[model samples]
Target: MEFATFILAAQRGYHQSSESVIRNSIEQAVASEQAGFNTAWFAEHHFNNYSLIPSPLMMVAHCAGLTSTIRLGTAVCVLPLY
Candidate 1:
């Protein structure tokens, strides 16, 4: 069996700052790797507070240093928007 984690990087409301949301997402990825997850996936979003991640590839680059074994990927990328 394989396990993976999807990081939504969602902000419920104004109570959560953008920095905190992104930081939390990074933390989640690190923790997921430590927990033996096979992969850590990031979601892409733009121009909205619902999801703060603009580029999953950038997020993957940031997390690559934090995790050594776990694979990293984007759940989905809206190419038209890029």
Candidate 2:
């Protein structure tokens, strides 16, 4: 038997990342397929100092390019907040 799991990614804050952090996250997503994740979620935010991910869809697209099995979505994309 097996249980499905979501692989969540974050732009929790811009201060938490650098050039390598961004590229590494995508690599991590690709690796998640081997770890058995069925989906991936990205955080969406704007005007926040830490979270620089403005578009969840773009994250989804990037993840889609990296992984073959995981579906991508927004974990908490507050429209009014962005």
Candidate 3:
């Protein structure tokens, strides 16, 4: 079985900046791969409150160099929404 984690840059507290959340999420994905996870999935969202990732492809591209074996994916995305 392949283990995976949903990577969402969530702003749970007032001090958590969007940039930091996104950076941390990327770091977590790399860590997840190192920890033996099979995949790292990103959340796609247009709104600001829920998630910081608007494009999973963008995240995948950014993380491609940072990760070696872990596969990257998106949870949900409407093609025409953008």
Best by lDDT: 1
The whole-model lDDT of each prediction reads 0.93, 0.63, 0.86
Clashing pairs in 1: none
TM-score: model 1 vs. ground truth: 0.94
- For residue 64, give model 2's deviation from the true position in Å: 0.7
Kindly report which residue stretches of model 1 are placed more than 4 angstroms away from their true locations once superposed. none
User: How many clashes in each structure?
Assistant: 0, 3, 0
The sequence of per-residue lDDT tens digits that candidate 3 reaches over residues 1-82 is 8899998878788688888988998999999999999998898887665788888888988998899899988877668976
Please provide, for model 2 over 1-82, each residue's C-alpha lDDT reduced to its tens digit, 9 standing for 90 to 100.
4434433434555565645555756666677677887766666656654455567777778778777776667776777755
- Worst window of 10 by summed lDDT in candidate 1: 42-51
lDDT of 3: 0.86
Better of 1 and 3 by lDDT: 1
Q: What shift in Å separates residue 50 of candidate 3 from its native position after superposition?
A: 1.1
Top-down lDDT ranking: 1, 3, 2
- Which order, best to worst by TM-score? 1, 3, 2
Residue runs of model 3 more than 4 Å from their true location after superposition: none
Q: On a 0 to 1 TM-score scale, where does candidate 2 land against the true structure?
A: 0.65
Per-residue lDDT of model 1, residues 12-62, tens digit only = 899999999999999999999889999989999889987899998899999
